[model samples]
Target: MEDWKKLYENPPETGVLFYNETVMDHFRRPRNVGEIPDADGVALVGDPRCGDHIKLYIKVKDDRITELRYKVFGCAAAIATTSILSELAIGRRIEEALEITDDEVIKAAGGIPSGKAHCSLLGVVGLHYAISDYLRKKGEATSGDKR
Candidate 1:
């Protein structure tokens, strides 16, 4: 596999070859890159196939996402996606945050490589899981719990 060897030897500097400037920026200095103690909602999700994992924390107040934080264990795209997702979710209603889509996250990060698009989807799914956990703790039916 000479081609594979060459590719590995010349890997992209930012870890993702086609990552735009925004993605590189976020990957280098991710926003909300931590855990929130006493968070209102917390979720941990992973893609076993790709070995990517994301942990999202949210603080909700009066049905609004007052704060957000995240930890990502993956490539540059994963970090950037979660970073942008945090920004989009904060200061918005929980329902609005839930509406944040993978495409929106990718676009906000200036677009990730097509091969890394799943990372953005992971960010969205992580948020959904966190929101569902919060609603459950509040004794409310989550979207999936509804008949």
Candidate 2:
């Protein structure tokens, strides 16, 4: 537990200093911090021992993401990544949002502290699974991979 804390909290100063103000703001107060009552798609992803979790809600229209929201419970980077990721997904087509990777989130945030890279993984994978769920529910073919 302590090791995880160190990993999340004791990132090198030189690394975190580069994060953009927007990232920091979102990290401190993540947007869309609640569940969608009747979400068209909802996904929960995390490592239990790592104490990271993210839940995504998506509404697709014409195969595009017309609405997206999320709830995140994790470290700073995870929350920041989740906030930015939801914003990124909202106006994008479903397939396009699925293409969003951890690298892009990190880059868009002006780069996350190196050791915190896994923090973004939760949001990335959560979105992937959520979209997959949506597609599967809609009778679209999928690999049926469950992470």
Best by lDDT: 1
lDDT of model 2 at position 68: 76
Listing every candidate in turn, what is its Cα RMSD in Å to the true structure after a full C-alpha superposition? 5.5, 6.5
Off by over 4 Å in 1: 1-17, 140-147
**Candidate 1 C-alpha lDDT tens digits along 1-147:** 998888777876664556678988888999998999998889999999899999999898999999889889998889988998988899999889888999899878876777888999999999999999898877754444454
Best-fitting candidate, measured by TM-score?
A: 1
lDDT of each: 0.88, 0.82
CA displacement after TM-score superposition, residue 27 of candidate 1 (Å): 0.3
Residue-pair clashes per candidate: 0, 0
- After aligning candidate 1 to the native by TM-score, how far in Å is the CA of 114 from where it should be? 0.6
How does model 2 score by TM-score? 0.79
List model 2 lDDT by residue over 64-83, tens digit each: 88777888778888999888
Query: What lDDT is reached at residue 132 by model 1?
Result: 91
List the candidate 2 regions with Cα displacement exceeding 4 Å. 1-20, 140-147
